[model samples]
Target: MENFRPTKRSKLELAAPVSHKNEQFWILDGNTVLEVGGVLFKLHRSRLVDQSIFFSHLLDERNVQMDGVVVKSDENGIVYHLSNTTPKDLEALLQLDKNPMAYYLVPPPFPVLAAIIRAATALRFDTYRAFAVKHLENAWSSSVTDLTTERKSNAVEVVVLARTCGINSVLKRAFYEMVRVAGYGLGDGEFDADNGERPQEISRADERRLERMREHLISAWLQVAVRVDRTFICPNQPKEPTAGTESRSSTLPKCPSLYSKRDAWERRVHDSGLYAEYKFDPFCGLQALIDIKWDEDEGWCSDCVHAKREVWRTMRQRTWERIEVWMGLDK
Candidate 1:
């Protein structure tokens, strides 16, 4: 982090009297002044300290005899330089403090929301942090699609933001949502397609988390596939031979024919190139299998396809339920 130093006043300026003028409507009768990204804000120290532990500790360290360790003194009073925070972010935080109800009524855009979360986390503003998380959760849950337009674009950044702010629940959901839509392998260029703007790059540590999640999801799919192989039955199988047909029973029973149908279904899944597709794209694979059309001429019965689709649906639902646990986020 780079340090932003305030302008130094000459020794002659120390003897000059200081006068204050109201700049913004929210200035009020504030004793502490702050400069963020070249914009000045006149706000009360007590109000800020009360809301944020970080602010409380920071202000407590300043010497009151020196007018609370002035960073810059002018006609607008003394100002403290707040490094790395933008004017917009500081304004949003102050607005939330002044009128929280109004702020929550109309949520900010994603970029502004990200800035607010970052500033709130750094300043240790617990109330604002919780408020942001609640809004994010609402945004995520309101859409029924695998991933909403906003979520598709911002999910990656939100994962990083949630981890930084210590919002574990959001982090887990965001990660799961990303995997659900984007699949196992995501290239850097594909990230920008969700929104026109380029997304913030995730750190290598976060990248590893995504990789681990993809591995778990793939394992879950493979397990479901194994279960399907063991339990699926061919609908075309004939009933067992009735009574004793004697010489007519010399012919092979129908059990081999039933097994052959099952084998053919499995072979078609591989031969049609779906098996390879499923390895890279699990959700799409499940969808493709669900929509499969069986032809009588191809030795596949409609009843068999229907039964297989039902099994796939059940497995998919079960896999969804266990994803959070597999990712170590159930707690």
Candidate 2:
């Protein structure tokens, strides 16, 4: 055989398979080989099996090969091909899975949370999925009283998470929050937190909804909110004495008027955004209206202070309801 195979070899035959390892998660002596996005990850077989039943069955030693690749070349080798999961997601899962004790204490960042939920859901890691959902429920809380609660993810990210995990408890709140912050519309480039390197995957429908809500909110703000408290009379201001029923000496102390207060309120409205370049954040903006100190010493009685607080409270609730209607989420 002058040798059909002797003189030369093709690049395909000469080249070795290309794959990368994530040093952050690659464990020494890990028995299972997991691949995502052409990157190989070595994970402890028992640990993965312990975390998910799907992994347990998928990594069974009884199955020797998958798609012609030797899944278990021997007891020392075990390969599992993963689909519909990204490297970042798998990496997040690896981090979370390795430390079960920490999950209860340290909540992951938004990016990590998004990644874990997506991967855990696809991989059937139920524990991680539930944990992520609970954490997110707090993050996107709908309660106006909990406005001070720190949040790692914004409404945009929450929308993505809700769609991915099918969690609806926070969807309405998320849609409301989206209009509060985001001004982007269809054809605008959005940030893809799920895959930083990829283009935004947000649908045009989402953009349209936000656009409509934003416009409606502005209209509601101008028509209803502005008109609701254009004038606030101090509830504690003494009423005009009825026909001088008693002597002038018996007159109660008059509550001094804050002539500039209404002007200040209007200015706040302008500062927080009546239009584009809005600093309006319903969670903070509505609260800001109430934050004005109504001190009894400043001519405001306790009743007046209470009245101001109550007005803002009612407004906040009303805004939420209006948001539901604008978004077509209202029943």
TM-score of 1: 0.60
lDDT of each: 0.64, 0.66
Over 43-135, each residue of candidate 1 has an lDDT whose tens digit, in order, gives 788888999876787677663332222366666666676674656666767667777787558887876677777878777788897897788
Q: Between which residue pairs do clashes occur in model 2?
A: none
RMSD of each: 8.9, 5.7
Scanning candidate 1 in windows of ten residues, the lowest lDDT window is 142-151
Residue 55, candidate 1: C-alpha displacement in angstroms: 3.7
Each model's TM-score?
0.60, 0.70
lDDT of 1 at 132: 79
Give the CA lDDT, 0 to 100, for residue 61 in model 1. 64
Candidate 2, which segments miss by more than 4 Å at Cα?
1-17, 21-29, 60-78, 148-154, 172-177, 182-196, 223-283, 294-302, 321-325, 328-331
